[model samples]
Target: MPGSTDERRAAGYRPLLFSIAYGMTGSVGDAEDLVQDAFLGLTRARQEGTEIVDPKAYLTTAVTRLGINYLRSARVRRETYVGNWLPEPVVLPTDRPGPAEHAELADSLSMAFLVLLEALSPVERAVFMLREVFGYGYAEVARATGKTEANCRQIFARARQRVAAGGQMIAFRSSPPERRAEGEQLARRFFAAAAGGDMNALLGMLAPNVALHVDTGGKAQAFGKPLAGRLPVVRLLLGVFRRAGILGVCLRPAWVNGRPGAVKFDADGSVTGVIELDITDGMVQAIHSVANPDKLAHIRLNPNEA
Candidate 1:
């Protein structure tokens, strides 16, 4: 019974651990690896007759430490990235499927918030995600990161302040049906405008200060820097549409990290890239496009669903 109980507990906490890892690293692949490594550590401990007083706490700490280390090393690669480094987009299930389906949790999982998390140091990111996003206490966060409670409190305070300074605060909650429908409509219009190369229509829908972040990872063709201002962004989009017209690729709306976005597909129906827009005040504020082939392996585009 005790063994079964331990197994159940491990299984129950896995999603939570995965959320924490993904929150810190912003890569589903990295998060999965970190979570698996943590569980493997737990199994090794059990085999060596080590008793874990609180398996959840132990596992959380393991995952956090692993995430911190991974981030530290991954920073070098990110620095060398070809262009703007956007977080890997992950699909969120529509229906409430598990304990991870809380509205606040949904908010934190957005690509925007994950991009902000990049501003924090590895330890600070872990502390902020554990304490603020996941609702862990100072004591728990401290244990997870091997920091004193006072140090963790300071780290979280600093991290929160840095995130707040990143323009506007994102409301981390699931959109109601009506609001979601509105956003979907806006996304559809924007997609159509881009597809038709209607620069004026796209300009009307874009906020004056709209910026575009594109990640090509040196594997695809993209701008070397983030494109800012409406004119520049519109010109870039028009050029892209013209090129897509020649190449026989088309844009179809899809959900990118729970937000309405478009995916690019070649004539053979293989995905070329995914684009996500951040909307505010009925206008597009920011656009994030990820064209890195390695980062898109987790997403399977349904050719028929559009």
Candidate 2:
């Protein structure tokens, strides 16, 4: 019975540790691997009778250290990566996430939010996550992250300033019923035009300063960098779709990360990518094309709707 309870405690560490590494790395795959590694380390400690009175804190520290190391070595790590990059967006059960879980999931994992976090150093990121998301005090964050209270406070202040500059909200709950329906119709029209290779039709709906981001992860060719301006993005998308000549790529409108999104599906029904749209004033402001197959595992689509 004691052993079973210990195992359950060890298992519970995953969500907490994943929240840590995923908050820093923003890559679900890497976050899961980090949690697994942290648990393995814990397992070893338990075997050796090191005794974990607070497994969550212990694993959070371990995962944060791993993320710190990853950030320190990110340039080298990206050298051999598959392609152009972005973090894998996490999707949590929002309707029932409640206040605690919603706050936990929201502050810990949104793509736009995490991008702001990327601006911080690994230790700073750890400090920010602990202090802001986990509700830890400066003293506790300092202890957890192995920093002095003063340094942790400074880091937290800096992070707060940067995050404020980003002008992002704490939560982006999916559009309400009526608004969502309207948005879905708009998404459907735009997606159909793009998928059908209608450059003019697609461009008509885009804002003059629309931006597009393609994440091929180096596996497939994509825009080497972010493409800005509506004309340029329209041209780029037109060129790619025209060149590929693949037919029947359908996008089903869905809510991912509490925003308007669509999943790309091939004729044979496999998910090829997820395209998340950010809109302002009825025009597409930003387009996030998530093409890393490894990352889209959490997204689901219905063929009947497609």
Candidate 3:
């Protein structure tokens, strides 16, 4: 439960609200902005002498609706996006694991899950996230979205189907410590192969039909379209790393979106890019690369880490 004062309550609930907003919008910047806006709305409402019987419910509704509206307006920009769009990666520290405040929803934070969410409509996404990811009951979901319980149920069903069709829904459960450790180990080998230019090892680790999706926002260097098939992806990766090596770039393994991934750093310790691996059954299914400086702006790294 949150504190009695509006400001204290907002502070206490920020993590929960941030998880919801990030899940809904798939953009860290947008999520933070939406949370701020929601709190501002709460303050204004209180100033107007409005009674807030349940601060949690009121804030949840405010953030969810703001996310819905934000997504509705962002669709146009997304449609016109120059290259494959990827959710801004949520990079976490690998050495010091933090408290699991919203760990139950971690799977939904993955790049794969967030990408599938793009297939859904604004309200549909809201209803589905509230019910599925957060475990909110139909009644609670309806209250948040201003819809009837029946409507919320129907929306959730439809959204679930759509997401499933787009791709498999990541289980809502948090990854066990051993599972996460295994993923980090695999990621280390994958990046080592790439950096060392060991094509054979890389090929062995990659799924046969693995695809490479890069988001450069047409503002940086990247393949204009996604590259499919193992050989091509491996070739491209080797070539990129070969070039990167010459430029004195290094890889620092980290937990990306709650999965194993790495951050790329330049000679001066600046973040140049991020790589998130979608591993399934001991094979890399997809390689998601984010090089657009705008997207990497939020990523912080210690240069000596690598």
CA lDDT, every model vs. true structure? 0.81, 0.69, 0.85
TM per prediction: 0.89, 0.74, 0.93
lDDT of 1 at 265: 82
Q: Pairing residues by index, what is the TM-score of model 2? A: 0.74
**Model 1 TM-score?**
0.89
Name every residue pair that clashes in candidate 1.
none
Give the alpha carbon lDDT tens digit for every residue of 27-67 in model 3. 87888899899988888888888888887899899999999
The stretch of ten residues in a row with the least summed lDDT in candidate 3 is 97-106
**Which pairs of residues have clashing backbones in candidate 3?**
none
lDDT of 2 at 199: 80
Report the C-alpha lDDT of model 2 over 212-269, residue by residue, as the tens digit: 8777777566767788897888878776656545676666665444456676777788
In the order shown, the candidates' Cα RMSDs to the true structure are 2.9, 4.7, 2.4
Ranking by lDDT: 3, 1, 2
What is candidate 3's TM-score against the reference?
A: 0.93
